[model samples]
Target: MVPKGDLAAVLASLLPAPGSGGLVGADALRCARALGVDGVAVSVTVGSGLNELLWSTPGVSTQLEDLQFTLGEGPGPEVAASGTAVSVPDLVREPVDRWPVLLPEALALGIRAVFCLPLLAGSACLGTMTLQRARPGPLEEMPLADAWIVTHALTAALVQDAGQWAAFAAAEDGSDFYRAAVHQATGMISVQAGVSLAEALIRLRAHAFRHGRPLNEVAEDVVARRVHFRHDDGDGRAPLAGGGTEGP
Candidate 1:
């Protein structure tokens, strides 16, 4: 059995650097792994669609969850939408089909169990924190408690960082990584498509999901002018106008 003090210690270790930003994704994933969870993923809803903040210690098919965002279905999306924690102790044994597309894909990828917790600050839902275990078994209560501690820690960190983006050096440290570009691209797509930022982001995720590609890669294409969105297409496709195909 895990001890509450041990969980508290784990959370203590997650404290963000003073005058630095929030905790890093890798750090959070590592912490979850240390607590003995199978996998951890951080997802946030930007505009209408959700984006992956981090997938900690994922399996070979880490991209599967991303597919859910693109397809607009899955445990992560459900948690984000409901602003409540959703736990599927055994994915294969679940009675109802929460995510028809994602469930089958997860089962195929050897992910037998899962737990998803919404990342929220008061009433504002920031995203979801998911844990996946390969074997089927109930999670120890202590671990669940620890998970909540971590989730609240993250929430606090996010709130702190938002008010002070420069508090963390990483926030100031800029990179051309796809995740950052994706945010920029989302803003651009929103303007170009004349759609709400959320809707534009959802469209971006749909395209990424349908094509079996990383959202970051899709965002890169958008930034490079290799891809563009057409609001006229109800199916969320890029028009073949500039050498880009019309499928996600």
Candidate 2:
């Protein structure tokens, strides 16, 4: 078990630097490892069922975020949407109905346990901090408490520093911090299908799921005119031209 004193110190030291913006990925990874989790990430909701991944540990953690964004399911999105924490001690033991698609895929990716804590600004949920473990189990009491501390600190940083962290993150490693393509495609689909932006996004996810492609790739295709959505298209599902769904 991690000592609360050590956790407190680590969190204090890693609090978002006003000059450098929010907590850096390295510091986040260090804090997550110290808390005995394999990976962790922070994200904010951009729109209905859309999130902007701010920072995350490398490897499967990053993949998990992408998967959740693509499938529009999982504890991370749940917490971001509802502003309530969602803890899955063991994915295998979880009811398939809870996340019918995300469970099998996440298990295949070696994620055994997951936890999501909301970052709240007053009564509003700004986003969430998602943690993943390779082994199946719940966090110890100390670690769980420390995780909440991390969320509170992150929330404070995001609220106080405003756009500094987001801007800094956008410049790091050429990451698409804002998920521009997803947003762009949603808008296009909204117009093409004559549907609300929320419905357009739902159609985008369904199309991605049907084609077994990543959501962003499909969005990129739509933005590139490789995929077209029409009001008459059944359920707004259309196959990519040339039997492919990737953008050129």
Candidate 3:
């Protein structure tokens, strides 16, 4: 439990140093420990269609982010859209209709609880901070307060030096923030299917779902030219361009 006086200090210690600019280092793991969560992730809302992952702890944290991107559902997206924090203390008790696809998959990944906090600048939500717990329980009072403090300070820092972070993100673009192969595959599908990029992404998600495969794996196949999306192909029906079993 963080004392009132120590809260400010805690926030300062967690923030990135001036000119460090981006949130792509060990901060997420450190914050997870401090917040008593198993893992944490921060992602920026890139326009209306994409939420680019900024930094995240390895394994489940990263997988959860990718799952949300693949299915376009989850607490992170909900927080980003509504500018409100989402706390699911127990996924098993959560309504299936709320996240019909994400819930089961996340549970399969061993995530029993989750929380998403909005990074807001004025009325705009710049991004989201997601925390995952392997056990089903609500965040304790102190950790919840600390999470808000960290989120507030982080938001202020990003908003105060918006240009610097923007340049940092642009420089890292595909390599750091966005998944390179997924972005590349989306473009390929857009061209091949004569659909908008947004629609192409939908098709990609649909394909990944139909095959019961990770979106990244499917995108890698597309980028590698193992699979192709022809104009005549419907959703989840990308044919094998090189005569293969499509993808796993």
Candidate 4:
């Protein structure tokens, strides 16, 4: 619960009265500062395995979500499964070995602390809110509580509008392109790679990371008939000469 004294300010920052750009607008980014955190991020994972980033407070938050999706491991997607919040006051000391690829990159990004809050609406787990910091230390009690409040408010906001979530999911904005393209590419790769859609998505992520490209960009190439994956173990994806889907 948010302290009453701070509640109004928090609401003003996150659920700003209309015309202030609303929650999906630039004004909402101020919520992180109001809560005393460096950055905040929001991601929605629909039942169909489609994940979209709703809000990324620029800089670190934006990059962090991208890496998490591309690497396919991190607190963002995992928290929804556990139905609980996960907090890391100090990543350097904790060394989240589970996220081997992410650890080094996160450390390089000057991320010393992180807290992930799961956003749940009714029986459905809507998404997650990720709070980040550049310094090492646990989030102070009040700030953590406020983040939870923000998450709850966000879920309610989305549920209240209802139509917006569908529009948000369908629209290209709000990181929808990446999730949609990844889902589409996964299905295509499944048949060509002789693997399941799950495996194909993973393979796509691996290929993108190895080639040092954005996952979404790689997905676009795959969807554009410019790339094809083989059942072969190495270099799962290869360029398709003449834009051919079938190769000799």
By lDDT, the best candidate is 3
Q: For model 4, how does the per-residue alpha-carbon lDDT over 51-157 read when each residue is reduced to its tens digit?
A: 67777787788878878888767888678777688888888887567688888888887998889988888767889899998988988988877788888988887
When summed lDDT is taken over every stretch of 10 residues in candidate 4, the lowest stretch is 239-248
* lDDT of each residue in 1-248, candidate 2, tens digit only: 55465466666565445454434323667777877899898888876677888778877787788789878889988887788899999999999999999999899989999988998889899898899999999989988988888888777766675466566556664434446787799899888867788777778877877776777778888989888776553544343321223333
For all predictions, the C-alpha RMSD in Å is 5.4, 5.1, 4.5, 5.7
The sequence of per-residue lDDT tens digits that candidate 3 reaches over residues 1-248 is 55444444446466455456445423567678888999988888886758888778888999999899888899998998999999999999999999999899999999999999999888999999999999999999999988888788777766775566666657744234347688899899888777888777888878887777778888889998887776663345443221123532
For candidate 2, give the lDDT: 0.77
Error of 3 at 6 (Å): 12
Ranking by lDDT: 3, 2, 4, 1
Task: Quote the positional error of residue 145 for candidate 3 in Å.
Answer: 0.9
| Residue pairs in clash, model 3 | none
Pairing residues by index, what is the TM-score of model 4? Answer: 0.73
Q: TM-scores of all models?
A: 0.70, 0.74, 0.81, 0.73
- Residue 127 of candidate 2: its Cα lDDT? 90
Compared with the true structure, model 2 gives a TM-score of 0.74
Instruction: Name the lDDT value of residue 88 in candidate 1.
Output: 78
Off by over 4 Å in 4: 1-10, 13-23, 26-28, 47-50, 122-124, 168-178, 187-196, 223-248
In candidate 2, how many Å is residue 238 off? 8.3
Task: Write the residue-wise lDDT of candidate 1 on 62-104 in tens digits.
Answer: 5555556556777888888889888777888876466777787
Off by over 4 Å in 2: 1-26, 163-176, 188-196, 221-248
Q: What is the lDDT of candidate 4?
A: 0.73
